[model samples]
Target: MCRSSQTRRACGRNDVVSTWDSLRLFSPAQYSSLPGRLMPSRPGELYPNAAHVVDYLADYEKRYDLPVQRGQRVDSVDRDGPVLRVGTDSGPWTARAVISATGTWTRPFLPAVPGRRDYRGRQLHTVQYRRPSEFAGQRVVVVGGGNSGAQIAADLAHARIDLIWVTQRPPRYLADDIDGRALFDAATARRRALDEGRTDAGGVASLGDIVAVPPVRAARDAGLLASRPMFARLNTTGVEWADGTRAEADTVIWCTGFRPALAHFAALRLRGTRGHIATVGTRAVDEPRLHLLGYGDWTGPASATLIGVGRPAREAARDIADFIRH
Candidate 1:
């Protein structure tokens, strides 16, 4: 199976229902819509859990009668004459164009810090984190400054563990009233401004970094979400700050984020220096037949989120249809 499919299947399982504890949608359920269908309403849930999302997608698939082949692993995608050849474990299929929606979930990124290999403790990325109880009785250091880092730190704070959340810089919290809805609106405004050749008003980044979700808010209010500066290096016992401050930790969780999973497109050789395919909107600049979706802002503003991907997806479909017609 593809990496994204594997992620979805794993998430659907009871043991690992979501990527992490307190993992809820950043946006309201109303904004989580596909091209034609709206997400089924969940009463009183402005932010629903990951399992809710899994159920919604499963139901969407069945209700739409989508012909989705389960467990088919795609190995490569390359040009074959005038069409694109998709090599999968089951067989090869040719297509006039291809939409690569395999998201970055499989490609968890862990930054290389000095002495990382020498540290004698467990280290994992956010993708590997499930619940806080697993790290009970241990001194844990959570890294990164993004939402995942904040959420994971908050999840671990109330548990029976010694938690130290550290970021590269001071953590920035969005206003209490700001949520994914506001972030999405900002993104939309930014996109519109750029399209009209107006001065850029900035997107979600201008607001702040971490959204104060229920757990995060509670943690912050209780003074459990205080973050420290990033450590300089890892030693046998723990991490050391540049100022010689050291903290012993049994585990380090890196919430550094992810990269696009584009290994399947290696055969196309479309990746540029930044390790991303240059695109005009969703269509690859080098390979017009190739369209990427749900990667991130490069594909379209806020394209990586549940609520943000629909517009870009619709545009990509329209582009694909236009390509096929000509």
Candidate 2:
């Protein structure tokens, strides 16, 4: 999405509003590809793995003739009156309107539990994790209750690793027939309930519920999907439960969440409560020129997911185009 406004401020050459055709955008995750999703049902429809996504993106870019300057690192986005001075590793690119669609891959949040830093076992976040084969024949504790946590724990379980899942509560597995779009609708309902200050949003299962991905389904069938209560702390050798039981683990894979990597926007001084830049829709409430996208529900409902991001991205794109045209 465009983060800059059309107002003048000693315009620079890289300004997207003036030269939207000059450069488009950038991201680090193989163009932000998700490899875990199931393949599309329609023939010739592909959006399953990272490779398929790259293929689709390549075709889209080719078809649209998008101006994508790869390898250019955005260092900072400093507000200069009506425009934004986007500082990159190469140099400054100025824009009357800039879109900050920077996704959350860069910032992996690890909860600050006692002894987490001092743990003797191999510690890695799901970010560093790939296949379960690397952790074969070892006692592994997969933390968190989200999709990654569920899938990775399932992976370990399938690989015959001594698997233990630690979560706040038992993980919920969604119906086998459920898909992301349906879940996203449920998420919308949940959000509305949250806004209305009603905790009882009955029937909408938590997005945190395991989506019954193939590996997870297999784990369920194998009866390996059981989860333990959150442990008290990490130990020198393993983790200690609140009830004082200690279990040995060769690896501790954190599936914790992440925060928005908006340190680049530090110059804007627009950050509000919970270290998030407050926004009305995608527009930053305090800084109208700035727009944030693909962060999470705070930026847009279900904005983090592939299916969810398109709406916000399209809307923000339209808004940016409109802002420039006006």
Candidate 3:
């Protein structure tokens, strides 16, 4: 339906550039277009814009003839005897097995701070950030220490905006040596260890660590990537520090991350703490008829990511197909 050049990814943070931080499975060819893959640069500057991934996905849909009905916002997923009925905004569809790939994009998490409502400055979540030019010449405060916060803060600083990067603690920047490939190798190793019944695989490098993309790299090169400790609360004009210090801002961008969008599965009674459904290799522990595709590490290591999603998706597909056969 969206033949327009401006789709969701184009409008959503289109100005923000990103590097593929890991090897996303399913579409290996699409992954080929990722930064440093085809578009190589020093320290991963040759990355694709967010538009590349969006377009690739669209093309993949057409190429595979995937029966994906866009614009059908699922309202609920309930069980009807042996089949599952997915209630949507448009209508209801019944399936033998349901694979919920409902990613975290719709649910942006903002930390609760006292007087958060009192701040008069423009407020937005990472979901709403498009470009830095809008905040040019304005004092901006970016919250959270993860990749989005780092990249966005870098964008604002590059625009010469009065920028304040605030994290709960200091942000961690990934080393220059660690590219997306290396992260994938680590994830693969972790997966292998898990399969071998080894619990001592130790900690693989966290994908949540910030990749040094061009903007972020430039920000670091210019000494602009520094983040202050999070402020205690929001006030009328700005944020107040825990130590009684305060800073004024024209806008606040919350990159605090997201929780899973699993409310649709509420009717199935499969939710766990923090909106997570416990899964054993993508199969819902309580409901084997359901498979969660890309809700993050609980489903599989790096499975929530672009490259990492492929492995779990492939596995879940096989399991679902086999289950349906039996």
Q: Which candidate is the best by lDDT?
A: 1
* Best-first order by TM-score: 1, 3, 2
Q: How many clashing pairs does model 1 include?
A: 0
Backbone clash numbers for all candidates listed: 0, 10, 4
Q: lDDT of all predictions, in order shown? A: 0.84, 0.69, 0.71
Candidate 3's C-alpha runs over 4 A off are 1-45, 194-208
Residue pairs whose backbone atoms clash in candidate 3:
23-307, 24-306, 24-307, 25-307
Q: Kindly list the per-residue Cα lDDT of model 1 for residues 279-308, writing each as its tens digit.
A: 989999999999998888889988987788
Candidate 2 residue runs with Cα over 4 Å from true position: 1-47, 189-208
lDDT of 1 at 214: 87
Query: Model 1 Cα displacement at 237 (Å)?
Result: 1.9
Instruction: For each candidate, give its TM-score against the true structure.
Output: 0.94, 0.81, 0.84
lDDT of 2 at 250: 95
